[model samples]
Target chain A: MTTRRGTEERIPLLLGVLASLAIALVAIPLVGLLVRVPWSNLGSLLTSDVVLDALRLSLISSIAAAALSTVLGVPLAWLLARRRFRGRRVVRAAVTLPMVLPPVVGGAALLFALGRRGVVGEPLDAITGIVLPFSLAGVIVANTFVAMPFLVLTVEGALTNSDRGVEAAAASLGASPLRVFWKVTLPAIAPSLRAGMVLAWARALGEFGATVTFAGNLQGRTQTLPLAVFVSLENDRNAALAMSLVMVAVSFAVLLGLRDRWWNNR
Target chain B: MCTAQRIVRRTGAVGVVLGVLSALVGCGTDSDSDTLIVFAASSLVDAFAEIGAAFEEQNAGADVMITTGGSSALRAQIIDGAPAAVFASANASTMDAVVEAGDTAAQPEVFARNRLEVVAPAGNAGGVSGLSDLARSDLFVGLCAAGVPCGDLSRDVLGEAGVTPSVDTDEPDARALLSKIVDGELDVGLVYATDAASAVDDVVAFATGVDMTTPYLIAPLDGAADPELAAAFVDFVTGPVGRAVLSDKGFAAP
Candidate 1:
């Protein structure tokens, strides 16, 4: 009994040590960010027109991308999670191709698919004379392409883990499939959906490679916060730090707001 | 009871001490002698790789590490205190920023010059003959962003022509613009002559009326761990062998 009790006591101590080490690894870089951030230029950096424009574009495009991803991704998630069709496993893997592929490659792929001379783009250009590159819309498209995977993966996980019996009961009660999804499955997955939205938004906000590749970094049009950070780092170190601080603060707020349900329960 | 509690506390303290000691050792092992870091512009990738290898061969018991990126990004990394012995930029402007920050050991030197060329997809379907053809409404044009050296030069040429191009895209680098042209996405793009040479099979050049050439610059950073070696590499790049390599790659001699 004493030996068993000693082993049990050692488990908590082991967990404590592991937890502290993990915390230190994550905290060190965050602490470095805070320590090295230029506090002196904080005021002027925040008010810079270019920085403001980039911030505004980042927020607008990220939100737009997340919204588009949610609209399109939710249905895809449903198909993958609720329905078991032919090649379902293959389709699920293909949906996550963007997450694993390099963002720059994804952007290049976007250009091949949607550029002026792209397969569909060529006909679109011939008919409408509209070009997608180096425009605000292009930024949205690139962000959506890279960020949709996050939403789909998260919501799919939530759907898979959910109690499917309730969904079936609702369907058997003369409720249509759409009604069952809206009234039962969606509410059950509300917390997961919120978490997925935040993840998608953050991913879209920090998107640099794909945005620069497909959209082209034209200031005030396609230059989001991350692109601005890259440009600022080239010329002004202080401004870069300040811009990074803003990104950190925004991300912190978002994660904190979602932590209670998304993290604690999980 | 008190004796047993004391023994447990002692073991816990020893574990904590060992953990702290290991962490300190891990943090302190980042020594300069491990390697010499060089930050260089993307344009100098081939030449610097060769020079870096030669430097390592000549200096026994020393390793050379090179980081290649956009000139602007490299300058930013140096300014942000990246541990680099040498810095080479695609243009004087980026090198000047490092000098202004008091990070340079000496004045930067122009090693080579690169001129702008109008590059189009192989077998130019648009029949683009010169710079003036870029202004045609029917042709799609891609140019580098104004922040990049090639883009700035391209703007100079366009200004001289008194032509306003219907630019469809402005990429961050000459390489990206060149890729768009090579993919047949654009009818023409402004790129470095060397880049056009590298992509000969995929792209061909048209004449530009204006001479908007850019010079490559190199400097050793202040307080570099291996200042002498860094300076020697810069000297070699500005010497005969480097000139030959640059010229062979279609770059103009400085």
Candidate 2:
């Protein structure tokens, strides 16, 4: 009985040690970044045209990507959750494939699908004279390709777990299907919707491989913060670290603000 | 609740064991004294592979491990304390960066030089004949991004020619630019002469009279585990056998 009591007493302490180790794994690198930040030269570095241009491009492309992902992913998620049909499993697998595919491979796939000489893109370019590769639109497409999986998976999980009885009740009470969906289902999954959007936005913002591969890296054009960090790392380590810190701060702010708004409203 | 607590306790023990094992692996290297780790630029991938094989054949009981990437990326790895005995960078500036960082145990020596050439699709599908044609608004041109050694050389040559091309993309490296040109996605791009030589079937090269060139530099790093082996490898690179390999690979003598 005494030995059992001693083991019980030690368990919490052991768990505490493991938890701290996990925390340290994350914290040490962050601390290293903070320690090496060139505080004195930060003003100049942040003011440089390269940094400012990349910041603006990152914001524009990531926001555009998140919006596109939500527009396309939500309906797809609903289909995956509410409907059963032939090839459903394949469709579902395809949607989440980007999550596992290396971003470079994803970029290559995008090129094969939408490049100037691609099947659809060739005809489109011939008719419209619009090329997608090496353009800002290419950045958005690449970002959306890689980021949509996050939003889709999140909303699908939320929809699958929620009670569908409310939707049926609304439908039986003389409400149209669209109206019932908006009034009952949409509100029910608002928190997850918001969370998914934030996660997708963060992923898009940090996207590097696909963006560089598809859109190309041109300052004030397609170069996002992540790409800028890669380029800056070639010449200036301090500038690269500063750019990374900027991304970290922005992502943190967005996620924190989302949590606060959702929790406060609830 | 008691069962849940027991599960958590088991998970905690597992996590502790995993952490300790990883820490042990992180500090321990199995090949203690026989391995020579060389960090090289991506452009040197083919040349260094051949050189490493030759070096291993000549030196008994010593193996050469080569890691290749963009010069800057390799330098960053070295700065972050990657276990490398020698570093062969594509440009002097990259080697200079290491020297400034005090990473070099010996003075770096230039082994080879590379010059830029204009590359386009086979049969000159773009009808681009010279460097000035790059400035044509209708043609799509790709150049290496600023800060990349090849890009820096491109900018220098373009400036000397007094022409600014309509560059639709700034690729991160010469190989990427070459691919786009070969794919006909880019009408033209400035790439190393060696790159042009290797991809002759895919891309046709034009002499642009651009004199800008970059030098390849090699040095033994201060943190090398086997300094003598590193020095020997450096000698092999600068030796006659190394020169023959580089020449065959299209590099100019330094």
Candidate 3:
């Protein structure tokens, strides 16, 4: 009896030590970023014209992609979560395809679909005389393609876990389907949507392969912060480390701000 | 609640064991031996791979690992303390960067030269005949970004022609630009002669002058694990065997 009690007491301590070690492993890279950061040159690196251009482009494209994903993905998530239909399982699998596919492969697929001579892209080009490849719009499209899955998966989980009784009650009270969704379903899932949006934005911000592949890496145009960090590392190590530190700080701040509301709401 | 607590406890214990194993694996290091790691530019992939195999055959039990990427990227990796025995860049500038950091064992030697060619889609979609036709308004041109060697050479040729073709895309590497041309996304692109040769089925090259020639340079990095083996590999690359491989790949001997 005493041995059993002692073993039980020791299990929690063992778990605590394991958790600490795991946290330390995860923290090591972040600590390395902090330690290697050039503090004195940080000012100049941040103020550099190329860094500013890349940061601005990253912000603009990430936000645009996140907004577009939310707009298109929320409805799709709703359909996947609430509606029971044929091929629903297949649709669910397809929606999560981008999440599993390699980013470079996803970029290649995007090129095949929307490139200048692509089936639809050719007609669009002929009609509008506009090309999507190697443009800011291409960055947004690539980000949205890769990021929409996060929004869909998160919101679908929220929808599945929610109390559908409230939705049904609203429906019986003569509220239209759209009205019920906007008033009841949306409010209940707002926390999940916010969390998903943050995740999507973070993913889009760190995007390198797709953006570089689809949009091309032109400074002040297609180059995002990650691309800039990569390109800067080619010639300037200090500038690369500085840019990495900045990105780490921004992502940490965003995640921290959303933590209390979206993460702890459940 | 008790049953749930028991299940959670079991999961926590398993997670702890797995985490400890992973940490141990992460800390494990490889045993030292007579191995030479060569990081070369992607353009030299075929030639270096052949040379690496030959070096291994020549020296029994001496291993050679080759990591290939864009010249700038490979150089950056070396700067970041990658355990590279030898560095071969597609251009002199990248080699110079490594030498400026005092990382080179000796001065880099130019072993081979490659020139840019205008590659068009399989059927010649844009009627691209030569370098001059690239500037036609109807042609959608894909060029490497200015930072890469191929792009720098393309810029030189284009400047000499006094024509600024409306570049539809600027890929980060010659391979990506070549892929775009092969995919029929771009009517024409500037790529290395070897790359054009590799994609002969999908792309046809247009002749260009000597102005677009890009020199390939190789330098042994200082503090290599196996400096003797590194020097031997370098010697092989600048010798007849390497020249034969490069020539077969359409690269001219410097």
Candidate 4:
């Protein structure tokens, strides 16, 4: 990957201009949000009852989604990466479909599959009297449906590129299959695992369309921070801005936490 | 041609197309000739849609584009300069927001009236024989989120009926709530009489025993692209033809 001398100086003006415009596209709206933020009472607004409830729910659902995604996505990702099975490619495509689908569509798909009158939802309800929609459980389900793809994709890439020699050696040294996975393979992909978890958690925290569509927007029950901001945008602009500030700050912190893994040059 | 020249030509073509697209977006149905953009409350969807087509037929070469949402949200957009040629609000205060902001060409006139009605699936009824079902915790109840005209009105109707609902989802708009009701998602829900009537095939409406007296308002916007045409459209909505269409769709005369 050696570069010739003065190659950076050859950068074209068109690309430089477009690159700056791209940066502005991402940065301007954020700066506008900062400008309109109600600075005087932001601390108080952030600590208000509604805000606190939303934050608590967001943390609970997002963390739960991330954890569930890891437990489920890792195995799926591994099978996709390592197994030579029929329909493996189909499974991988299905797993990643959520990443590209509009989250509202994903939520509607969830409703069709898991709603009260849904395919599985009908039998599940008839048997257990449990309805997934319009519940806190629904919020977690929606988040996991949309966020799991990130974890699965990242972990699968890591697994595919990971060294298998160590696990084979550990197996030859009398380690059981489970011990090889835990001791040799798990630690090897730990970096990617951590990165994947954080990415999935951040996606879950910011999830809006699916959660709102599936869980419904009830303050203190199903209203995550994003939904709270949306409901408030009509009547309370200051509150929406305050909540958005919290989201932006948290997202920045998550990105900073992953800097060591992704921003190796820094 | 050189590869660099080809890239430049492609970029230029893209730039021109983007420029044209943005110009069209900037106009946003604000032109004086063909398009008439109307922002109406969600409950007025079926009624206004009919009125729009009739108006279009009379005013040949004029297209009517209607955007429907919660009245409060619609007013917020109008006040923020969405360039809507006409606005039809479900409540007076929602229309007042635009009037107070000086975005209306004139005072909004009361054109129709609607009230809340409870509804459940037409068949396979969910024990929703009366308003009492809205209070049942076992059944899923849906309503428009607070701050929208329908949400505010729904709360009023519920309060007058003295039934405290176990609301499951506060939909962003009344139409979204209505669609879900028709989908058999909700056991019972409160929606505009007009909405319930439009969806009579799917839902069975019940009287909440509360009279709904809210008056619907419509007006021409201040910066309408075609001021004369906008005023004409407003007149058409408040006129005899509009009245007939509104009543046919289950709206009461204001």
Top-DockQ candidate index: 4
| Tens digits of per-residue lDDT for model 1, B153-221 | 788889987878777666767777888889887898888888888889998897687867888888888
Residue A89 displacement in candidate 3 (angstroms): 1.8
How many backbone clashes does every candidate have? 0, 0, 0, 0
Preferred candidate (lDDT higher): 3 or 4? 4
RMSD (Å) per prediction: 10.0, 8.1, 8.7, 6.3
lDDT of 4 by residue, B133-187 (tens): 8898978899888887788888988898898999988988777788778877788
Error of 3 at B210 (Å): 4.8
* Share of reference contacts found in each model: 0.53, 0.68, 0.47, 0.68
Best by TM-score: 4
TM value for model 3: 0.86
Query: With candidate 4 superimposed using the best TM-score fit, by how many Å does residue A50's alpha carbon deviate from the native?
Result: 1.7
Tens-digit lDDT track for model 2 on B97-198?
888999999999999998889888887868988889889878888998888888888999999999988888888888878887887778898999998998
Interface RMSD for model 4 amounts to: 1.2
Stretches off by above 4 angstroms in model 1 are: A1-18, A35-44, A127-130, A264-266, B1-37, B50-65, B125-129, B132-140, B155-168, B221-228
* Tens-digit lDDT track of model 3 for B131-158: 8777776777788877677777889888
Flag regions of model 2 displaced more than 4 Å.
A1-11, A260-266, B1-33
lDDT of 3 by residue, A1-266 (tens): 23555566664878899999999998999998888889987899899998899899999999999999999999999999999999999999998999999898988888878888787788888999878887899999999999999999999989988999999999999999999999999999889999999989999999988877777777787889998887676657788898898899999999888867765555
**Local distance difference test, each candidate:** 0.79, 0.83, 0.82, 0.83
How does model 3 score on DockQ?
Answer: 0.37
| Off by more than 4 A, model 3 | A1-13, A127-130, B1-34, B132-138, B210-212
TM-scores for every candidate against the unseen true structure? 0.82, 0.90, 0.86, 0.91
Query: Is 3 or 4 the stronger prediction by DockQ?
Result: 4
TM-score attained by model 2: 0.90
Order of all candidates by DockQ, from best down to worst? 4, 2, 3, 1
